[model samples]
Target: MLFDSGVRSGSDVAKAIALGATAVGIGRPYAHALAVGGTDGLVHYLRSVLAELDLLMAINGYPTIADIRRT
Candidate 1:
């Protein structure tokens, strides 16, 4: 399942995955990015989120998003 609402950082995505979420979502940050920075902000925010998620996965010992396990 995809998680949302409170999801803000890569760590949050990792947590959701660990709890059995197959996917995560972009909510306020996404909207805010677009509104505040236009296309550039949205693009930047998306990349940041992706990078954060990757970093979190590595820190949590998951080689990939598919490998994240339930805590």
Candidate 2:
């Protein structure tokens, strides 16, 4: 399994997954969110990232992470 770090956005996560990353590190964004608005902010941030990833997958016709790797 490969772990990719330094991810800043949903797009970055998608790209890393597409490039065969088994997992990703997204600590920076979470840290920023926590510092800005606490737990709620972190929750919102995570939901936003997932939503963005879902949108990108739909736009690209990728039904799953495995499908993304085929691109």
Candidate 3:
């Protein structure tokens, strides 16, 4: 499977997936969130990223990851 690192935002994740990445490494964002506010910060950060990805998918008419890959 293909894995992409250096993902800093939801858009970056989407781009990687669209380009056929099977997984993404998001260590930096998680580390930053953890350092800033511990567990709660990490949760909030993850939620925000998922929300951004959901919004982008809706706006672009992509109902699933497979659809994103087709683009």
Candidate 4:
């Protein structure tokens, strides 16, 4: 699937995976974070996005990102 742009949240990441994306790419958000908070901020943002994706998977009854395909 085509990602619109830089994903803003983990939920967005989950949605992309659930909808069948081969990978999630970061661009704009990283640039923005980098400009605003540098590497550390970018790291924090990326981690939060990952955590959110995991939580969404669990709450949606998916044990893993692959499960989202079946869901």
User: How much lDDT does each candidate structure score?
Assistant: 0.84, 0.87, 0.88, 0.79
Across residues 1-71, which tens digit of lDDT does each residue of candidate 1 receive?
A: 77886988877877788898877887899999999999999999889988998887777687867787745
Model 1 regions more than 4 Å off: none
Q: lDDT rank, highest first?
A: 3, 2, 1, 4
Cα lDDT for residue 10, model 3? 83
Query: Least lDDT summed over 10 consecutive residues: which range in candidate 4?
Result: 1-10
Candidate 1 C-alpha error for residue 39, in Å: 0.9
The model with the greater lDDT, 1 or 4, is 1
Find the number of clashing residue pairs for candidate 2.
0
For 1-71, candidate 3 gives per-residue lDDT tens digits of 56557887788889989988888778888999999989999999998888988899999999998999888
Q: Give the alpha carbon lDDT tens digit for every residue of 41-70 in model 2.
A: 999999898999999999989999899888
For model 3, the superposed segments whose C-alpha errors exceed 4 Å read none
Measured by lDDT, the strongest candidate is: 3
After the best TM-score superposition of candidate 4, give how far the Cα of residue 42 lies from its true spot, in angstroms: 0.8
